[model samples]
Target chain A: MFTQFFYTLKAYKVPVSLTEWLAMLQAMEKGFAGNNLLSFYYLARSLLVKSENFYDQYDLAFREFFTGLEVPEELFDELLKWLSEETLKRHRDSVDLSSLPQHDWETLKKMFEDKLKEQKERHNGGANWIGTGGTSPYGHSGVHPGGIRVGGESNNLSAVKIATARKFRQYRKDVTLDVRQMKVAMKKLRHLRRSGNLLELDIDESIDQTCRNAGEIELVYHPERKNDVKMLLLMDAGGSMLPYAQMVNRLFSAANSVNHFKKFRYYYFHNCIYDHLNAGMEYGERVSTAQLLKNLNSSYKVVIVGDASMAPYELFMENGIIDYYDRNETAGIVWLERIANHFRNVVWLNPNPPRYWQHPTVSAIANLFPMYQLSLEGLESAMVELTRKAH
Target chain B: MQNFEQYCGTGDYIASRALQNDVNVAIALGRPLLIKGEPGTGKTLLASSISEGLETDLLVWTIKSTTKAQDGLYIYDTVQRLNDARFGDHDISDIKHYIKHGKLGQAFTSPKRVVLLIDEIDKADIEFPNDLLTELDEMKFYIPETAETVSARHRPVIIITSNAEKELPDAFLRRCVFHYIQFPDAAFMNDIVKVHFPNLEEKIMKEAVEAFFSLRELDNLRKKPSTSELIDWIKVLVASGTRPKDIGRELPFLGALLKNEQDYHQVANGETDTRSIRRPSFLR
Candidate 1:
C-alpha cells in the first residue's frame, strides 16, 4: 500500500519526507490498519504529501495506489481536511514542476528549434507559400537567414540598394587594417612550423638582433615565402576573460582577414602555452612547429597578439598555461627567437590597454623579441606594416 | 536494523515512507511488502529495520546462488539424531521433530511478528520465488513429510528484497507491494552524514560532501559515492585535520565513488577539482 503511495507522491510532485513520516507516525493515535481507509489516505497525505493539487491527484493516485483495495470514505475525508497549504501547493506545483529546466540558448534552441524545423521539413510536400506557414513547408518566413528578407538583404541587397552601395563604395573604397585584429591564432596547434613564427619579417628586427653581432646576427636565414611564413596566437579561454571572449574571437576574425590562416599555417601558445601546446584539449596531433619552420627560410612572417598580462607567475608557474604537468616549458622568448631567427617578419599586437603595455613584465617580454607592439586603438595606423612590406 | 546496515551506509538507503506505509498496510492486511533496489543500496537494511522497529524476530533467509525453498524450511532431523545416537535409539518420531523449525517452522512458531527477510529473492533460481508464493499467499507452509501444513495465526511480516539482476516473473510480483530505491541526492546525503557523524568541522564537512558529490558528477565518474563511503571520507578528513592544499592529495583515496581508474588518475593529476565552474572575470 505504501509502495503505491511512494510513486503516488512522486507523480503528484509531493515530496514524502522520511523525516516527516516518522513524525506523522509519532503523532498518530492509532495503528494504520484499524484506521478507516479514508483516514489512512488523509493520514498519508498529512504525513507525506503537501501540495496544492492533492485532491485531484489523490483521486488519481488513490485509484492507482489503492486499486483493488477497499477502504472507508471517512478516513479519506480526514486525509483531505488535514492537508497543510504547503502540501497542497507542493502537489499542485509538482504537477506543473515536471522539471522543465531553464534553458541556455543552445539548449533552448536545441529543444524547440529542432522540433520546429522538423515540423517544417516534414511539411515538405506542402506548397511552399505564405499563410502556408500554417500549411506550407519551409516555414512561413524568416526560416532562412535573410532568405528573401521581407525588408530585403542587409548586405547583398536589391539592385537599387546595390547601386547606392556601389556609388558609396567608390569614395570610401578607402579601407584600413588594425594590427591588433591579428587573431589568426594557430589555435590548439601542437608545434609551430617547427622552426619559427612567419606572420611578418622585421627586417628592422633582424638588423637589431644582428646588432648583437659584429656585422650579422648570424641570421639562420631562409625566407622561403612558402616555408618561412609563420604566426602564433594565444587566447585566454576561461575565468574573467569570458566577457572579452567575443572581442577576442573577433580579433581572430580580423587576424584571418590580414592573412588567410590556411595559407600560412602556424603554432599556438597560451598564457603559458608551454609544452601543453601539443596536448591541448583542442589538439588531435602535435602540430610540429619545428618541422614547420625547417620548411621555410627567413622570408616567413610572424605575429603575436594577446592581452599579455596575468596573476603572478600565471605566465610561468604551476596552474599556469603550461599545464601543471609541465613546469619547465621553454620561455615564450626562447620560443619566439627560435621562430624569429627563421622569419624576420613578426609583430606583437596587445589587446591590453596601451597604458598597461609599459608594465615591467610586459616590457621585459616585449623587449625580448624584435616586436612592433601596437595597441588595439591604433588599428588603422598599424596596417600596411605587413601590406607595406609586400608592396 | 539488521546487520545489513553494516554493509550499506545510510546514504545508499532512505527508509521510504511509502514502503513503510505499505509495510503497515501489509501488516494490517496480512500481506507482504517486497522491495527492489540496486544491489548495494541496502534493500536488506529496509527489511531488517522494519523487523527490528516492530520488535519482531528477524529471520534472514538470504537467497543464494542455488537456493531452493525446501533448503530454508524444515531440514530433516534424521541425520543429526542418527549421528548423535549412532548405534543407538533412532526413533522415526524424532525424525518428524527434526523435520521441524527450519526457516518456515521457526517463522510459524514464533509468537511475535516474525520478519522473514527474503533477501535477494532475485538471486535464487526461478523455482524458489515460485515455490514461496503458496506460503506467502496462504500464510501457511506445506510439508509433505509432516502431512499437516503449518500455519500462523498472526501472519509473520514478509519482506523481500530483489536486486533485479534479471526480470522477475509477473505472476510472482503481483503478490507483494514493490518499492524501488535510487541513489540519494546531496541533501539526502547531508542528512545521512549528520546522522552518521554528528561532530565535525562545518567547513570540512560541507567541503567533504561537496567534494564527494562533485567527484560523482565529474572526473569521468562511474558509480556514485554511496552513503557508507561518504562516512568513510568524512572519517578520513576528521582524522587528518583537512587542509585546503591537501584536498588534492586526499581526494584520490576516495576512489570508491569513482569506478574507473582514469577518474582516480585525473583527480590525482590535478585535472579534476571539487570546485564549481564559476566564470571568473580575469582571463580576458
Candidate 2:
C-alpha cells in the first residue's frame, strides 16, 4: 500500500500530514499518476510536499524507499568497486588493529611534527609516513582507529554518504529565518490607533442619528485606524558577529519590508554600544548615543541584536573599547544602562543560544534588559513583551 | 461529475509535461491550482494559457497588500447608500441596490464557466488566503446583509499564484493542487524562445542562448535574468541586425539581460571567463 513511504516522509521531518497523504491517494485514484513510477514520483511530490524547502528531504525519502529503481547502469561499476573496497577495509580493520602503534597525545603531536619535517613529497597508501589511505594514524580513510580524515571521500554506503552530505541544510527552517517568516513575525508589533483624517463614513452611527431625527437624514464620519507602532532596531555588526551576518541581514530585510510601522529605524554597532552608533553597517555616518536619546523618546520599542561575547574589561572598564582610536570615558555597561533606563520597553536579541549566555558580558547585559534568543518563538515573545503595558 | 476539457500547451506558451499533467489533474478534480516559481517564470501567464487552451473566459483578481477577502466576494457600498439617501437622487430603501459583485461574485454568476485567476495571493495579508477557504472549497458564499447565498452556476476553474511573500495557511493550501515551476534548462529555454520567435536565425539563436546562460552562471548576481529577459534580449538582437559572431566577443545590449547595477558592471568588466561558443551541429 506504500504506507511506509508516508511514514518515511514523516521520519525525515517533512511535515506530511494525513490531509496531504489522502490528497495524494485521491490523485492517484483519479488516474493522474497512471502506472509509471516516474509520473507517480512527480504526482506524489507535487501533492505531498507543499514547499520547495522540503523537496530535497522528499527526494531523499523517495530514494531511500525506491532503491535501485532508476539508478543508471554506469553506476554499477562504481558500486562494485565500493563494495569490494568496503570488504577490503573490513578485512584490513580486523588485522590492522594489533599493528597500530599506541602513542600518547604529546608523543603523537611531536611525532606528527617530526613526520611533517622529514617527509617531502605526497604519500598515498602505505603502512608508514603521514599519507592517505593506509595504516597510518595521522592520514585519511585508512584502517587505523581514530585516524584523521583529510580531504578525501569517506568510504561508506551511499545512503550514509548522501545523508551526511546534507546538501539542503541551509533550507531547514530551524537553521535560519527567511525574509517572509521574519516579516510575519515583525507584523505582530502593530498597535492600531485612529489617527488619520476622517474620510470613512460611519454607517451605523449615521443610521442611528437619522433614526433619532425622525424625518431628517444625518451623516457621521470617523478617522481611519492605522498602525502607530514605532520601532528602533540596533544590530551588532562585524568582528565576532560576522558568522551571523546572513541571518541578521534577513532580519534587517524583513524589518525593512514591513511598511506598516509608523516609524522604523535601525543602526549598527560593534560588540557593544559605546559613545556612538553607526548610521550604516559600513560605519559611514555616526549618530551619537546622547543625540539618539535626545531625539527618540521612550515610546519607541528598542530591539538590540548581538552575540554579547566580548572581553569583560571591554564592557566593564573605561577606555577599554576594542576600536583603538575611539576612546570613551563611560564604560559600555554604563551606556547600556543609560539606554535601558531611557527606554521603557527594551529587549536584547542574542543570536547565540541561551546556553552560551554564561559569559560575563552577556549576563551583565541580560540583567540590564530582558534577553531573548533570536528565533521565531523568541521574536514573538519579545514582541509580546514590548507591546505589554508598562507601569 | 461534469465533463472537463483537457488543457494542452497553447501556441504561445510552452508548458512542461509535468505542469501540463498537474493542470489537467486540477481541472478534473475541480480544485484550485496553486502555481509558485521565481519572479519571471510565468506563474501568472499559466492561468491565461489554461484559459486559452480550455477556451474559457479568464477573470483576474490582482491582490495588493491592502486587499481584503470580503472585497473579492461582495462589497456592501454603505457609503454610496448613505450618499443616495442624503442626495435623494437614487433608491436607498433596498440594501441590495448598493451591493456590488466583486471578481469571485462575477465568476459565480457568469453564464458560462470561467477561469478565476487570483494573481499573487501572497501579496495581501497573511490571513487573506484562509479567509477565502470556504468560498473556494464549497464554491458558495453567504451575504448576511442581503439575506442571499451566492453559489456557482457552473464551477469555475481556479488558479492562484504566489511570489511567496508570506507563507499561506495550511488549510488554504490543503484544498488546492500545488506545483512549483522550476527554471527551465538550456534545451527547454531554446524551445521557449523558438515559440516566441519562430523566424529567428539558427545561428543567432544558438549564440544568444549560450551567452544568456553563461551570464546567469556568474556568481553573486542579485537578480539573474529569466525567460522574459532572454526573450527581450533576443528581440533586441534580431531588431538591431547584430552579427551572431559578434555576440561571443562583445555582448551588445547587455542591459536587457542584467537589471541590477552590480550585475551589469560585473559582466561589462569581463570578470567572468568567456567559455568557448561552439557552432550548432546543423550549421556545419
Candidate 3:
C-alpha cells in the first residue's frame, strides 16, 4: 500500500530504501503507530529517513503524497495532544478492545469511506458519522475504541501541514556549506604514512616472535602512521570574489583548523595569481609566485578558490593584472598553468554555480584545472579530486 | 515475543510527544535509534530516561576520535595474556581469561534488558558505524579467539547519538531508526526548565525563558544557549535573588548561558534588541 509513498520519497531524492519501508510496515502491522496520523508520520519518518540532511526532501515527498490534506494547525495540534493523552491512558489502564463491536478490515474500510462521504454532504451535525467528537467508528476524539481513525479529515486540509512546513530546509546538503561541514569535507584529505618514530606495538609481530621463541614474550614496535598530505590553498580575494568572501573565509578557517596536514599554507590573490600572492587579504606579506613554486614541492595538493569570473584580457594578456599598480610580466593564465603543472593534484573551487562556468574566464580556468562548485557535494568531490593520483 | 514497554517522558526529562512516539516505536521494533541534533539537546539524556522509565539497566559507551568499533564489542587482552605467560602467575593457556567484554558486549550478556547509549558516534571514524552493522543487526558478535558467540539475552534498546560531525555510511544508517531532536520551542523549554527547577517562581521562569530565547535569536552568535544552559542560567537567577522584572533587562549571570566570549559580549553590549526578539513562525 505504501509502495507509491516509497516511490514519491525516491522521486524527491530522499534515499529511502525498501528495507526501511518494510520496517515501517512491520511497525504499523504491530500497532506501533496505533490509529493516529501524527503517530504514523513520526513512525514513517523515523523508520525511512536515515539522515537529517535528507529530512527536507522527505518532508517534500510526504507533502506530495498527502497533498490537498491540510488539517487546521490548531486542530492537528489538539488531535496530537488528545492522541498522546489517550495512548498514555491506554498504557496506564491497559484498555481492552474485545468488548467493543469489531468488523473485518474490508468492512471497516468501506464503512470509513461511506461515513467520510456522509460527513462531507452533511457538513456539521452527524453524531454517528466519521467526524471529530462523535461515536462514529471512523475518526478521532470519538468514543469508538475499536474503530479505525481515518488518517485525515475530509473538507479540511490533511495532516500533511506538518510536512509542508519543511522545517529541515536548513539541513539540506545542496545549500551552502557551513564551517563545520567544510571541516568534515577537509578531513577526508588524508594521506597517512608511517613517518614518525616507532611508538606503537606491532601485536602480530610480537605474537609471532613469542610463538617462535617457545613461550617467551617478545615485543615489536613500529612508527605510528601520520598524515603526510601537505595542502597549498590559493584563494581569490577582493574584486569579483567579494560576494563569496564569507564562504571563502569559512573554507579558509576550516582548512586552517584541520591540524592533521603535514604542511598547510594559504595565500590570497585578487583576480588571479600574478607576480606574487598576498599572505593575507589584499594587504599582507607578499610571497612571490616564483618563490612559492620553488619552495612548495610538486607533491603538495593545491586548491584554488575563486569565482573564476574576469575580463578575458585579464587572464590572457600580459600585464593584465586587476590591480593597476602591480605589473605582471606574464599573463594570469600562464601563472595558473605554472601552479597546475607544478602540483601533482590541483583543483579549482568556483563559488559560482556550474552553469556560470560557461563564461570565458571561468571556462578558460576550468581548462587549466579541474573546477568544482563551492557547495558541500562539490567540496567533497573536490576533496576526492585532491586525493586522486595524477594521470 | 516479549512485551516492549513504552517510554513516556520521565519526571526529570520532559520529552515531547513526537520524541516519545519515536522512542516507543524504536523500542517496539527493537532497532537502534540513531539520534542527530545540535549539541546539548538531551540526546544522551534520552537513553537514561528510557532506561529509567522502563525500569531497566543503562549502559553508556562514549566514542572518541580514536575509538575503534572493535573496542566496543570485546577487547582481547593479548598483552595481559603475554605478561601473564612471562610471569607464570595466572592461567595463560585459557584465552577466555584474557577476554574483556566492552560496553556492548556487557549489554548483550546482561541478564535483563538494558538501554545501551552510544554517545557521539560521529566522533569516531566514518567507518566505525559500518563496522558494527552486523553486530547491531544480528545482536551478536563471534569471538574467534574464544570460539564463542555472545548473543543478546534480551535485545538491549540501543540509542546512538550523533553530532553530525561526519556523515555516516548509508549501509549503517539503513539498519537503524533515525530521529533529529529539534530544539525545544519556548513553551516546551518552560516545561524542561520546570523539570530542573520546580521551585522557580512562574514570573521569573517566564522572564528567564524569554531572556534565554532572545539571547539565542541574536545573529552571528557563535554558540546559542541550549536547554541545559537555560536551566543553569535560571538557577543562577534564582540563587542571585534577581527580581522577575529585571530578568530580561539585566540578564543576570549571563555567563551561565553564553559560553562564547563574543556571544556574551554581544548580549551584554546591548547590540541585540532583546525586547524585539522575533519568535519563529512555527513554534512546534
Candidate 4:
C-alpha cells in the first residue's frame, strides 16, 4: 500500500533511501501517523523529506498522489495569489493581443470612466466592474483582451493603464555580493590606458623581458597597468526605491566589491538628481550641486540606481520635492542636465522591471541618461556601454 | 504528548485556529514546521511557546549568513585532538572527547523528545538547507572522527522560521510542513495587545489600535509600525498616564511608531506645516 507513496517521493527526487522507507513502514505498523490523511502526509514527508524549500515541491507531489485530498484553504489562497500575478504577467507578455480590436485613446478613456461609475460594490470574476479575474475590461488577476487595472496588483499587461499607491521598502545598503562573479563582470569597466608604479610583478612580461636580454637573468621592471576607471554612484535611497531594496543592495555591493577602479565614490539622493545630495541619514552632509560639479571631473562614470517612479510634479514643477525643504533654485531636470553635461558617460540602473520603463517618470529620466535594468545582465551591458569609447 | 493539549490551551501565546491546525498537521506527520513571516510576527516566539506547551526542552540554533550546515552537526576538533595526542600526559586517542554536538545533534541525542528551533534558516547560504536533507530525514548522522553513527533516540519537534529575506530552494521547501503567519488583523491585534497589556484601559487600547492601523495605511511611509511597534507605542502611552483622546497633542513622540527618517518627516512635517504636506484630508 505504501509502495506507491515511497516511489512517488523518489520520483520527485526526495532522496528517500530503502532503509528510510523501511523505517517509515515500521512506523506505519506502529500506527504513529494514524489513519488521518493529513497526518499521513506529514508523517511521510517528515520521514522521507528534509529541508523547508522542498516542502513546496513535496506538497504538490502529495496533492497529486493523493488526488482529491482537501488541502488547507490558506495555502491554496496564498499560492493562487502568487501564481495569478506571476503567471498572468508571463502569459500576458507572450500572448499576442495585437489581433484583438484595439481601443483608441479616447475610447479607453471613456470606457474607464464608465467602469468607475458602474463599479459600485466589490466584484470578482465577471465580464465588467473593477475586480479580480474574468474577461473584464478593468481590474487585475483576470484575463481580458485589453483593460485598465484599478485597486488590484498588475499581472494582466492587457491593462491600458494602472493607478496604484503601493509602498516599497528602502533599498538596503548591507547586502553582500558574490565577489568572484562581480569581479569578473566589473573587469569590463577597466580602463588600462595608463601605467602606475611597479607595485605588483607581472610574471608574463618579466619572463619575456629576461629572454630578450639573452638569459642574463637581470629583472626588468615595467610600470604596472592600473584600472583607471573612475565611478560616481548616486543612488536614490528613499520613497519609490523602497521596493527594490534587495536588488539595489546587490548592485551596490557588487560595485563596492570590485577593486578595478581609479576612484569610486557614492552618494544618496531621494527621487531625482537635485541640487542637494544627502551623504547619510543622520548628520548627513548636504553637498551642493556646484561643489559636486567642481569636485568630480568628466572622467567619472556616473551610475545611478533608482526606480525613478515619482509624480511628474517632483521632476518638473518647482518646489515639488517630497522630503526636506524645497527651496531649490530650478527644476530637478535642470540639475540633472548640469550633471549630465559634467559627466561623459552615465547609466541609470532601474531596479523596477524593464516593462515599467514606459512609466512617465522613468521615461523622463531615460530621456536624460541611458537606462538599464538592475540585473547582472543589465549591469554587464551598461558596463559595456560605459567602456565603449575607452575599450 | 497528552500534556500538549493542556500546554496549548493555557499558553500565553495566542494560537489562531489556522496556526493550531498547521502545528497539529506537522506533529501528526512528524515533520519540521517551516514558519515564514515578516519580522516581529512571532516566528521566534512560536518555538518557545510550543516548547513551553509541550513540556519539552527547547534547543535553539540561531543561524547567520556565514553559518554552515556542518555547524548544526557534531564539530570535530581535530587540531585539539592532535595536540593532545602529541603533548598530553595521558593517551587521549578517543575522538569522543574532541567531538562537541551542536544544538540539532544534542536535540536528537536527548533522552526525551526536544523542541528544536532553527531560527532564521534563510539567513544561511543556499547550500545549508540542502546539506541537512539526509540527516534531518533519517534523524541520524555519522561521526567520521569517532567512526560511529549518531541516531536520534527520540524525534524532535522542529520549528524552523524564516524572514523570507532570500528565496529557499524548491527541493528544500518540499520536505517540511509550511505555514505563513500573516500580520494580525484589527480585532486579532486587540487580543494580541491584551496578551501583553492586560490591565490597560479598553478605550486607550481601542484608540491605540486605531492609530496603528491608520499609520499602516499610510502607503508613503517606509517601515510602518509592526505588531511589536504598536505594543511598544501603547506601552509608552499607558506608562506616561496619557489618555487615548490626548494622543493628538503627543504627536511629537512618534519615534516608537515610525523608524525611517523620511516617514518621520512626512508625519511630523505634515502635522506642523500644512503648506509643505501635499497629502489627503485624513493625513492632514
Reference-based lDDT, each prediction: 0.49, 0.79, 0.81, 0.67
Chain A TM-scores of all predicted models: 0.35, 0.62, 0.80, 0.50
Model 4 C-alpha lDDT per residue in residues B126-237, reported as the tens digit of each score? 5689999988888899987778888999988888998755556656665576776757889999898998888989988887787777777776564768888888888888
Q: What range of 10 consecutive residues in model 4 chain B has the weakest lDDT sum? A: B1-10
DockQ per candidate, 2 decimals? 0.01, 0.27, 0.61, 0.05
Which scores greater on TM-score, model 1 or model 2?
2
| Candidate 3 CAPRI-style tier | medium
Q: lDDT per residue, candidate 2, B86-159, as tens digits?
A: 78989788998889999999999999999999999988877899999999999999999989999999889999
Better candidate number, 1 or 4, judged by DockQ: 4
For residues A132-226, could you state the per-residue lDDT of candidate 3 as single tens digits? Answer: 44444555444343455444342212346678898889989898488899988988999879977989899999989889989788898999888
Query: Per-model i-RMS in Å?
Result: 25.5, 3.1, 2.1, 11.4
Worst 10 residues of 3 chain A by lDDT: A87-96
Better of 1 and 4 by TM-score: 4
2 versus 4: better lDDT goes to: 2
| Candidate 3 residue runs with Cα over 4 Å from true position | A69-158, A208-216, B1-5, B270-273, B276-284
Residue pair clashes in candidate 2: none
lDDT, residue A289, model 2: 93
lDDT of 3 by residue, B1-284 (tens): 34533788898998887788888888888899999898889999999998999999899999998899999899999889778878988978889988899999999999999999999999988789999999999999999998999999999999999988788999988888899999988888988988898888999999888878877776567788888888777778878899898887777788898899977775676534357445432111
Tell me the tens digit of each residue's lDDT in model 1 across A236-346: 443444555555555555555544243454444555334434424244555555665676566544555555665546644444443544454455445545655655545
Q: Quick one: best TM-score, which candidate?
A: 3
lDDT of 2 by residue, A68-170 (tens): 2222346334333422332223233233343477664567667766775677655666666655556665544555543333433434223334443555555
